[model samples]
Target chain A: MATEIVFYDIPSSLPNKAWSPNTLKTRYALNYKGLAYKTVWVEYPDIESVCRQIGAAPTRNKPDGRPHFTLPMIHDPSTGATIADSAKIAAYVDATYPDRPSLMPAGTVGLHRAFEDAAHPLIGPIYPYCLPASHALLNPVSAAYFRRTREELWGKTLENLTPAGDADRVEWKKLEDGFGKMDEWIRASGEGSKYLMGDVLCYADMWMAAYLLWLKLVLPGRWGEIASWHGGRWGTLLQNLEKYETVL
Target chain B: MATEIVFYDIPSSLPNKAWSPNTLKTRYALNYKGLAYKTVWVEYPDIESVCRQIGAAPTRNKPDGRPHFTLPMIHDPSTGATIADSAKIAAYVDATYPDRPSLMPAGTVGLHRAFEDAAHPLIGPIYPYCLPASHALLNPVSAAYFRRTREELWGKTLENLTPAGDADRVEWKKLEDGFGKMDEWIRASGEGSKYLMGDVLCYADMWMAAYLLWLKLVLPGRWGEIASWHGGRWGTLLQNLEKYETVL
Candidate 1:
């Protein structure tokens, strides 16, 4: 029997919200593997209880001494296996569905991890730049929850945290430079090498695609420019994966 | 008859010199692939002429209009083919000797290229810190050539180009932080993943191993601490590739 994978994600306030980058990574991986899976939408506040109710493994303890919870968790009904963490979930999908496409690829887990490690930092500094737009996308309750939690984490109000006017431009330039280097990397891999892993859609592509997708959803007006940067490399890479966009 | 690969390298003044990281990459690839290869040592001045005579393709011209010639070029006697550029040479090695061990894992050329692109920059800023020690190891003739060319390239004299005292320490911290991220990446890949590509060796491992080897070669007295950074992670990765250090 085909395993019915239950994918979990945080729902934004928007009527037809896209998956967060973290959730999109797992969702994309499942789609790439051609697995039969269904989404289980969870509100931001209920993530902990839902995950715990489903018996998902706790990631780590937070500062408050409570077990940390995260989205993009999965439950495989056939095996009765539950996996949390996007990376681990991808690994599980690869392992369980041996006949499906491998997300990490054979003997590339370290490089894949390193690639992710390297890419995340480059993309991280830009998150605060999108704060205003991101905050607007969240539902009222979730927005309040996000603000309270993020303010505590960032130690700044969202208004003060988000770069304003000219500062925002500088931040965008920094992000562009980071993405530009990655674009050059993709091009230099080999002649006509399109995807991050070269000519094939792999997990790394999904990671970047998810990030780009989030940008598209949160900062609609800015997406055009960001996509156009690097000779439309980022946009085309995302476009190429249209076939793999299964869950909304 | 097996093809004999002619490995090109810049000769240093030191008696027991190792190939530069650029050259070591290809050399390591040849060794890893178990290919039969012999070193062809060329002085800095003769690099252009030797490569041209061997029919290797020319790199782009420098701003000063001098045609750039680089090492780690290879001549395959059996095919009468000469290839320049370490990345290209590695790719050639993988293709020509398909039955042997692959330098880049299958379906990972782009990610491998990207990983390399990301890594090299992290290690690049450390080059200036090693300048004084590097110049000391070069032959007088090559040192003169290196100084003139690098000064023109860097717009600073070799002595002044090298980071001094406090600047050097800051550079070291930057390098450590870069490598620390990479170490976290390696650990996060899986529970027991040791090498850059996870457990098994690949081109990325060779790239890092080559860089670490260069630090050891150029700064003999100082390589100890740098290798021991990140809780001996760098040392462990280099040690893991002990079997692949064949071309020296």
Candidate 2:
């Protein structure tokens, strides 16, 4: 039997639903490597129990002293290794499946990590713009859990976080500006590069592509507009990853 | 005779001086490639005149309508090409001398640019903390010009920019936090990696090493403190680049 990797993901109310940027990274890696993997759906509230059962580490400690667990964890039944955290899972998968197509090109792990680190702060301002739309897509149970937990974390209700009217435009402008900078950076790399890492897509591209997918999923209506904002560059890049789409 | 590249740099008063992170990237690239190059010192007031004489385009247009100019421009007498931006210069050099050690490996330019873009913002907050010390190390003419131009740009005097007191500590804390995040990202790349792109040093590493060198030139005392701040991992990385240090 082919080795099976059990991928964990958060499910939404919408049919054919799976959207969590972090977990999507692992999924993309698995798909890119052509590894045989089966995804196990876990709700927002069950992340802790699911991760704990698989022996995955806590992402962080919560305010109430409980360990904050996150999804995108995976179990490699063949190796009996369960890895949590998207980056960790990526590194583990890449190292174990050396002969498979590489997610991180040789000698780029650190550089890629720095790139992700740099882009991470930009992701923060986008949350306010995305959270409300994302809330609507979550299952009733997941939506309630997501709303309450995120409200406590953000110190604002979802609706209040991204209120309609001029406020939404203002928040969206911030996200657009951030992505604009990214576009400029990509262009500055000169004519040869199509993806963030150039012609061939690497883990860094996966990081971005997965996030773009998540953005499209949660805010289906606004994505086409936002994707077209940077001269349709981001949307085009997302389309480039279509070949790697694996049936879940 | 082998073609010698003309490297332009900002002048300082201190002996054995070197500054300007952008140009430092070019210098590191040349050194890594073991290329023959001669330094052409340009003071703050003379950069525009020199670059214009060399036919290098202005970096950007200023708010007041004057063409904005910056350092690290290069003159390739052999090809009669004078590139203005450090990134462009690096690309030109890496391409012209294809067999030399690459500043950027093939198919990685766009990814590297994203990495550089991500780290660029962190460099901004450190300037306020370093500008005063940097001013002290500049030559008389350069120092006076630096002070006046920077004061105008910042809308505050250098003395006021880095005030001595608890306030400085607060500013420093912010810088440290930025670097701390970088350190975390580096550690996340797994065990085998050393430089930003893993064991092999690349353009991104040069970008950082050059900045660290500037920090040392501007604030010698703080460089050691800051280098050691992140458990000396940064210091070790800087040391790793020592062999690539070319004598100008």
Candidate 3:
């Protein structure tokens, strides 16, 4: 029997940015493995209710309460297990359906480590750095809705969560500095390789693709030039999502 | 026959900080697998000789040469392949020697994902934020020595890498914010288990242990206290390292 999966989604928000990466990753893994599953996209503010159904959110009744109430929570009805954390969700989807082609390669620690290094930078400050700037441009109604949802999930105001005062300026500079580092890495990687892991499209490509998607939305001006350069390397990676969209 | 592995190291320096984590991880894997190899600790600022041998550094003849000139580059003499990047090195060690007790677990993706998430915040601004402050505190002679070694390896000054501008302050704030988020993760992860993976140790524990060691050295006072608190719970996860100290 096919496993049933529910993916809580927000209509239009940055936290949804976190989900998009894993949603695409999970969908890719499912399709690669040739497994079948269903997805449920919950609206913002109401995701709390969906989380309750899966027992992944903090609750007075449950013995242990999780720290935050973020979305991209996955509920496996078949096993009655609810998992949070995007990468964890991707791994769960891959492991539960092992008969399919493995998204993670066998006997390749270098591959796994590369994925870890690439994924970590995106998850830490990079995603958070992009959020406020992207959200600032939203219409007042959408912005208010976004802020309210963020507060509920993070248990703090978005302003407090962001790099404030001098810190904010420094983070922007660091982001700019990172572009040079990325450029250096691309040049060193050489032109012939199809993916970061050579020929096979691994998690590194998926992560870079997801970040590029968010970058495109949040920093369209910068991303437009980046997208055009290198003869559409970033564009090709973004379009690869078609392979994983079925799981979504 | 065991695979031949060579690690380039410096006795005392911060860039050498990269070596410790990679060494610790590879050492544990070697001990777990009962593999044997050679250990060579090169003097600081003198690794240029070693880099020249491996074709990793720049010389007058080749100013912009090789992928990276960073310390702790590994040469797999047997395979005639050279690999850098600490995480990638660890993975290669594990994959090349399959008979070892797996640093990662089978049938679990949550464990692997948790390890990646936990390790990411450490390497980003968290560790880099401490550099300038440490450099400022050191005496001129010592600071000069430290800066020289950095320039030799990275081909850039630390000041240029992390400027004293407003942008640097923002990076610090982002790191400080990360400390809070990590604390929350530690508190919330107390969900009826001691380790992140629960019941048994995994790669997450090893990665955290290695980071804790670096934190103790760089941000000694506060990070030491935090490390002790979490270290108490995860200490056993690292006990296996005692047998692998020779390689480290």
Candidate 4:
């Protein structure tokens, strides 16, 4: 009656072979929901080709307005569904496996979806800090591919993506400043809350924890600084979700 | 039996005598909940003195870091509780009146709260477009107080707060650009949802509608232009909540 759900992720030289925040969002969702899924690591260069081979649709358009395929995509054999995009993957699994624990509960589908959009300001600027380190953590093929694509996108070398010395401090400070605004929102969840919504750990939590996981993995040495930034709020968030960090 | 809640609002020369976006947040919340409340008009200068007289706490601090009193405060004689700040007022009412319809629902308190934080980029830039018009809409005493305090805040005269001619179009375009991001978020609320949250309207809807109401009242003619942005998305939001536009 049950079949393994295949999750497509980007492989890394790092431990557990998962370094992408986007893919981890779906990974966390599956683990949280107690769903059985196997990780299929696709290198950066092979993502589009692999997705095309699987008939997975592109999530969004690139700068030139051409369709761009992304991961955290899932192919569920139980439902015979192939869902692309992390949010869509989560939604698909949740809908397909209604008997399991829900990542997005009833009436919360839209709220958690909005959470991604709402969090863009804080999450968007984090790429520069992690980009160079991420490249270093990748295998040669994916590393070259990541560097080439990201450089073309950002129009700067990965080393120069973040300035060295005190300017880096200023950049990190700007990124750190984004946490306070988010802290206020979390605090508004009735005194002390670590999750995005109150009590129930929804997909929004996965969205956050996945990003923090990427930070923890890619910037292992400096991740503590970010986690400790907002009164240990970010750190506490990751620690609470440690149970769902299983790589399976 | 329920005693009438006293809802404090800023008075304007415009019809219905309500024009402040901040105060309208509470107004819309109270009306949407079907709470029996009477509006008590407060002139701009009297906000501090009146709030102090009624023992309502200051919502936030002013530029000098001193406590700043504001309207949209509420006095619930039934519980002898005085609540300041629109968000606080909504939460208090929801908790106090469990029998009444809820504004900020049980789990959504945080997400909707984040919605406010997330929407600031769009909503914060809108002040300049309404400031001069808001000053014109207020009574003379309040007009003088508003212009004086606002100019002091911006370090520019009310007339200089916004540019005229083609440059004004540039400014308006910048403001309009903000709506697209929000549109993407709102559109994520399932297919063609007019409210911030799908299915059940929440306080987040009040947050948006209240601001739109202020724009409608203060900038009547030009308000339609704002509503028409994002493919009449905002206009539909205000339209869906028209029943709650009652001023009692």
Candidate 5:
């Protein structure tokens, strides 16, 4: 019998038990591949210790130059491998479980990576608006940890992280323009295109859908606005990937 | 006989008769597709006039808001279509021919565009060094025009556009790192991968090879130096696509 993969995720106080887009991407990948995985919930403060105990390497060095551990790691007993980072986890699952459908189609792993890199500008501008909202959703312990970490990065209070009032709209508009450019490129798929690669749902779609889901969870009103932009393309994307939104 | 596509190019006094990476990209598409085409060389000063005369739409507006005409345009008499811009031209050729090996394969056009967008930072950082070298290769009329125009954009003389000495090396290193990141992403292609789409050639590969070829043309010394970076990946890529480097 194949052992269940041990997936690690951060718990949000939200009833759905998911919030971080980073971990949501992995959850979607596991569910889409029909992999049996049991979630191990970790708190913001314990990420480094949990990752260290399990032997999953840190994803990157923090701004302070220390190894920075992150959630959305997986320990696959099937291969006795411990992988960290959503992207690496996706690749590992796809490569190990060849019988299942691949999130990255043949010869497209690089293109998928490129799409995600290009997508950073699309998703990044929305971060300031999302941070305060996201910090609000965390439990007390994580809320404090999240605020301190993020505030340190920006050198400001969480409340001041994003521009307020009309300025926020201008900032939000930048994201809209970014999405419009992305939509323009993807529309080269011609009409009725729902995903980046047209019909098949690749890792890039999972990455995108994960962020769309994050916005829906934390910033509902703004999420509603996003749905109207780009001809409801994003709304339709979330709808299509609804099956993989399973919280388990 | 089918009417030939009119390919617009900016000529360099270099023995090869091709210098601009932008134009080289379109030329690669024409050759790669085995399309019938003839070059209509447009000097730097003549670009806007030639584009206006042919009714090829201006690619974009200039800093002062006037329509900015740039090259690598194609006028297909067979279809009576005038396409401007390298990417759009590449798309038009692939879409119009229908019989040639597609530069963009099924379901990959959007991915190709995304890859190109992600590639800009990689290609852009190298431009400062290449500009003066490129101007040196242009004929006097084009050289004067190129200097005046680019100086207007940078508010600096052609010779002063790029950093010199140790500073230039530092600036050049930024490009090396950008290419390294791209190589890292594409290395997801796993072992023995030759192109962005693994074994098959795609527009992204052509897009990259065009710049690689451009660097080789104007900056032979630095080009030779680049061959050693990223395990000779750029060099090998150019070597693999050598067949399509033909000047027509």
Candidate 6:
């Protein structure tokens, strides 16, 4: 019997697909491990219910008496475990399916560590783009979707994640700076190897590919310099994932 | 014969013992694998020369006219590979010594993913505290010897990291909020297991323990709530590192 896995999705939330680096990291792990799982497209408001059903809900009460809501929580039916936090979920999946292609390398702890370091900062800057108040400023469609999603899902105005009138340009700049750092790392390392871990795909590639896709989607023209710096491997990696785009 | 590993340390500009969760993770892997390595301590301001010896310097035009300087880079004699990122170094160590107790759990990619997520946010807040500008504010010395030792090791300022200011409070709050979320996760998950990943210690525990120690040293009273939430397991973990206190 196949193991049952359920991935909770929210279309407008970057944590939805824009958080793709992490999502794809997990997805690739599942594929590599040859695991079959179901995907549940969830509306934002319903995320809390979904969390409770999976037992990954935080043990705190929301104002509406539901568990504190977060997304990308996965429920594993076979083990009767619901894990939240993407990395934890990924680790659990990797551990349970030892026979599958490893998301991590066989014996190189340093490579694994580099992969982690590479993956961590990728998500830092993209987080603010998800908030309704924050999203509205970046693009109208996102704002409308966030507002509608907020009303439909939470029955209220989206809480201001950033205080009113506070410009996020500084944070965005830091993110850009981080991407520049990444670009340099890629140029330095990718010059000699086919992959970040050298000669093979590993967690680092999955992470960079996913985030690059997300950045391309959200920031569009802005990523050209860094994207170009990736020297085609980054684009090819994403192209390979077109089959998985529906899930993403 | 024991595998030869060399750790380059700078007294003042040392990677914050706390920031070096990956380092500790690697060190623990080394201990678990029973690998023997020598340590070379270099004084700050002259760390560029050491970085050059390994050919892992980050930029061109170092004090030694080689390139940019970064620390905690390692040279693995067994593989004849020079690696700079601490996480990568740790992963390499684990891979190099697969026969011993694994730093990574067998067949678990998710575990590694979880460890990265847990450790990523730690750098933002803890970094400022370790900088010379913030050192007096965060770590007023017991006096001459202690102060001198810290100055000699960590350097008077951070070169690679950008200087932080009051504006970073927003990020600091985010980091604090993250701990709240973690505290809740621990309380909910601690029901059946002694560690985050179940019975045995894994990278998650090591990452958290190391971050908590840094928080204790740098942030002091600020992390009391989270520290208390962790209770005895947290304290015992720090106590185990008594020998590495200075290096940390």
DockQ of each model vs. true complex: 0.45, 0.60, 0.07, 0.54, 0.78, 0.09
lDDT of 6 by residue, B1-248 (tens): 54478876533232442233434554554554567776665544555667776777463454456556655677878788877755566566666777766555543333354435444664455554444333433222222333454555556534333334764566566666655544444443335445544455555556666676656655556555445543555555566554544431
Candidate 2: where is the Cα deviation over 4 Å? none
The candidate, 1 or 5, that scores higher on TM-score is 5
**Reference-based lDDT, residue A205, model 1:** 81
Alpha-carbon RMSD of each model: 4.3, 2.4, 9.6, 2.5, 1.9, 9.3
- Interface Cα RMSD, each model: 2.4, 2.3, 10.7, 2.1, 1.1, 9.9
Between prediction 1 and prediction 6, the one with superior DockQ is: 1
Q: What 10-residue stretch in candidate 4 chain B is worst by lDDT?
A: B189-198
Candidate 6 docking quality: incorrect, acceptable, medium or high: incorrect
Error of 2 at B25 (Å): 2.5
Local error of candidate 6 at residue B232 (angstroms): 1.8
lDDT by residue for model 1 over B1-248, one digit each (tens)?
Answer: 75677888877765646548788788778877888888888878889999888888876677878778888898998888899988788878787778998888776676776677678777877678666567777888888888887778788887787676898788778888877767766775667777766677788878888888787777777678877997787787767666766654
Candidate 3 - CAPRI tier? Answer: incorrect
Q: Ten-residue segment with the worst summed lDDT in candidate 2 chain A?
A: A184-193
TM-score of each: 0.81, 0.92, 0.53, 0.92, 0.95, 0.51
Evaluate residue B98 in candidate 1 and report its C-alpha lDDT on the 0 to 100 scale: 88
- For candidate 6, write residues A1-248 as lDDT tens digits: 65678766544444433333445556655655667777776655566777776567574566687557665677787888887655566557766777766565543333344345555665576655434433533334445655775566655565644323345667666666665555444443434555544455555566666676766666565556545544655566677654545552
Q: What DockQ class does candidate 1 belong to?
A: acceptable
Model 3, span B1-248: residue lDDT tens: 65657766544455433334545555444455565566676654455667777865332233465433445567777777676555455556656755776566442232244345445754577444455445554445546766775566666667666635797678756654554444434443334544444445455556656655544555566553454453354334335444544543
lDDT of each: 0.79, 0.79, 0.54, 0.82, 0.86, 0.55
Q: Which has the greatest lDDT? A: 5
Model 2 over residues A1-248: C-alpha lDDT tens digits?
Answer: 65788889888765667677787788888888888888889889888888888898888889898888888888898999988888778788889999998788777776677777777776667677667877888878888999998999989888788756887677677777877777765776667457666667788778877878888888787788877877788888888887665646
Worst 10 residues of 4 chain A by lDDT: A106-115
Mark the regions of model 3 whose C-alpha exceeds 4 Å error after superposition.
A1-6, A12-41, A53-68, A74-77, A80-85, A103-144, A147-204, A215-223, A229-231, A246-248, B1-239
Sorted on DockQ, best first, the list reads: 5, 2, 4, 1, 6, 3
Question: Which stretches in model 5 have alpha-carbon errors above 4 Å?
Answer: none
- Residues A1-248 of candidate 5 have per-residue lDDT tens digits of 76899999998889977899999999999999999988888989999999999898989999789999998899999899999988888888888998999888777888878888898887787788888999998988888999998998888998888877898788888888888877877687667777777888888888888888888889997788898788898898899889998866
Error at B140, model 4, angstroms? 0.4
The TM-score of candidate 6 is 0.51
Q: Could you give me the TM-score of model 2 versus the true structure? A: 0.92
Screening candidate 4 with a backbone cut-off below 3 angstroms (N, C-alpha, C), the clashing residue pairs are none
